[model samples]
Target: MQEFEEFIQEKMNPTNIFIKICTFLLLCSTLAYGQAGYGATTDSVYGSSLAILSSPTTLPLSPAPAPSPDYEYVNLTGLLTVAGPFSTFLKYLETTKLIETLQAQANDTDEGITLFVPKNNAFSNLKKVSLSNLTSDQLKQLCLFHVLPHYYSLSDFKNISGSGPINTLAGGSYTLNFTDDSGTVHIGSGWTKTVVSSSVHDKDPVAIYEVNQVLLPEAIFGTDIPPPAPTPAPMVAPDIAPVADGPEVADGGKGKGKGKGVAANSSTPSSSYRITGRNAWMWAVIVPLFVGLIVVL
Candidate 1:
């Protein structure tokens, strides 16, 4: 009986060992599958999508805004209204309706307008018969004669000067000769010659200069224009100032007298010479006296 029990135990022990070996093999396979599935990045199901996200491509961005235009707005009516006390000129412009033509030219940026406007007093000083005898068409041409169809800055006239007569807005023979003398712009119509007193309004596409006299065109007033008034004699008279920048400045006024100018400073040098000679004489006396005292000692 003991031998039979021992044999049965040995057989059961071997079967138990076989079962444990199978269990160990199954556990090792499960651990290797889990490591391969979870540890490797390429083994993931989302690998392709992750690769796309990690790529070095440029992202889409919002486009930039458009640039603005360079057009400037200039209104003539509003400008002349507040520019100065040229109401007489303004009234004539309104009555003739020439402002529309001038304003239209001002609106164009490419070919702008340059105008010469006279003050109220200029019209007041004008002879009534000159304007009173003009027909509507003649008056319109006369007003148009005051303006140039092109824009010219004050400095630009320097080059335009002495280039023969340039065309005015009045067209045809109604031309004006420009002379820029020492930075001053002078306009010469056949009937009237005037200079730019001041700049009323200066800007791109529009330039309005103030003139002392009303412009009368030869087209309206005829070519029998009177000669320019003779220049007034200098207050100093010809004998007073023989040359330019003369020394009339003795009394602190510009006398333009060269001799007087030198005379103004001549007193100072004479005074300095007198002081120097007096000091030299004093020094000579003192040095000799000191030398004599030393010798005596």
Candidate 2:
């Protein structure tokens, strides 16, 4: 019995040692595979993040907007006060308080004003009775007659000219007539006929033109405008062609005929040639008639 037990112990010891060695190898392989997988996953995640951060290309951000501009105003009083030695007209405007009205019109953005300012002498030269005789309302109208509510550049005169009388700031028949001759603009208010002799200030929103005479309205002056002096007839040196003597036929009773020629002058050779040509033509016709009459008789 002792010998049989010893043999069983020896075989069991060899089998147990072989099984423990196989189990240890399997655990070591599993630990190595897990380490490799974690290293690869960590490297891929961190490397991708770093690559994105280092790249030169960047996504664009939204843009901002731009801004706008401002308004412009013109000064009228300053323009007139300096441009014209227009003190006399300005005095009338101030006295009538029409200057304020004109200044407001000049500043208008859409439609501006045009003023025809007469020189100082225009006011002085007027017959004393013409202005002195007027009432307060008439005086105001006289001042108002000089302004056109709409701006009119010199070139723009062509369009409004010949359109009959244009209404002035005075409103009613206290209007003025405009006529454009070539580029010259003529203003006729019946009593006053004048021209835009010069431009004091010509700009958008304000235009002040200088006139030689104050615009005299027919509404104030009686319509009995004097008959315009007749222009003397032009003297034309006499055209000798009309009074020229042509060839005359002299036929005596004896049936002999002679042609009398037009007397030619040395100074008028061209005219003499023309008359000779006409005389030859006439003689040709008259001779034929005389020959026909003689044959019939």
Candidate 3:
């Protein structure tokens, strides 16, 4: 009996040691997982429920939430208060009486909008060509070409790289391209200009992408300018060959027939030599004499 008790203790000791080792391993694993920011639940000896533990550290999330679009109902006049070169464009919009549409809102419902405004210099460049002289419909067409149907933020632009076209209210679309490593935006063929400021006045329910220049659709400017009237196809006078007045028909018949023969003979030129006709001589000789006179006179 004494030997058996000693054997039991020996077995119990190993089992307890194994249990302790397992507990130590489990604790280490929990700590490691917690450090890695994993959530864990542990059961306490006290008759309470499991305790949940969350990692203390958290990763910073990317892509902040988009701004609320609420104030876009304001017209072009209101936009002028917002800084940057857009103010000048707003003035032109007002002068052009485009503010009316921008300010108009539904009777009670609020809606969001996107306005792609060209810079003042863009208008100046356009004005130099006297495009403002174009009819109202044409001017509106020009303005609409700059606008997109949807509100787009700068973050949206980065993904829009490569050859992709977005339809505008302009009755056409503009192609998008990435011009810089930092994702500065450019629109239209060749990606000519950079987006100087993006996501301005976004809370106004309008997304405005302020680029360095006006975005003109390829169609608007791509057409070949008509070749200037092909230089009026030089007026060339037709070259009329002089007639030799071929030998008059001679009738060998004599007496009464002789009269007819003489008449035909009289109509014939006295010689076979070339007679410089009025217009013909002017081109043949007068042109040379005129050159000589130019030097002499």
TM-score for each of the candidates? 0.55, 0.52, 0.42
Best model per lDDT: 1
Winning model by TM-score? 1
Model 1 alpha-carbon drift over 4 Å, by segment: 1-68, 228-297
Candidate lDDT values, in order: 0.82, 0.81, 0.58
Candidate no. 1 TM-score: 0.55
Order the candidates by TM-score, highest first — what do you get?
1, 2, 3
Give lDDT tens digits, candidate 1, residues 187-207: 888767799999987887789
Better by TM-score, candidate 3 or 1: 1
**Cand. 2 Cα-lDDT:** 0.81
Distance from true position, residue 157, model 3, in Å? 1.2
Worst lDDT window (10 residues) for model 2? 251-260
lDDT of 2 by residue, 1-297 (tens): 888898878757877778888889889999999999999999999999999999887799778666533324556566667887788888788888887888788774468889999988888887633687888888899989999988899999999889998999899898888999998999999878899999887877778899999898878877887765599999999865543544332322222323323333223344424667789999999999999999999
Clashes of each: 8, 0, 2
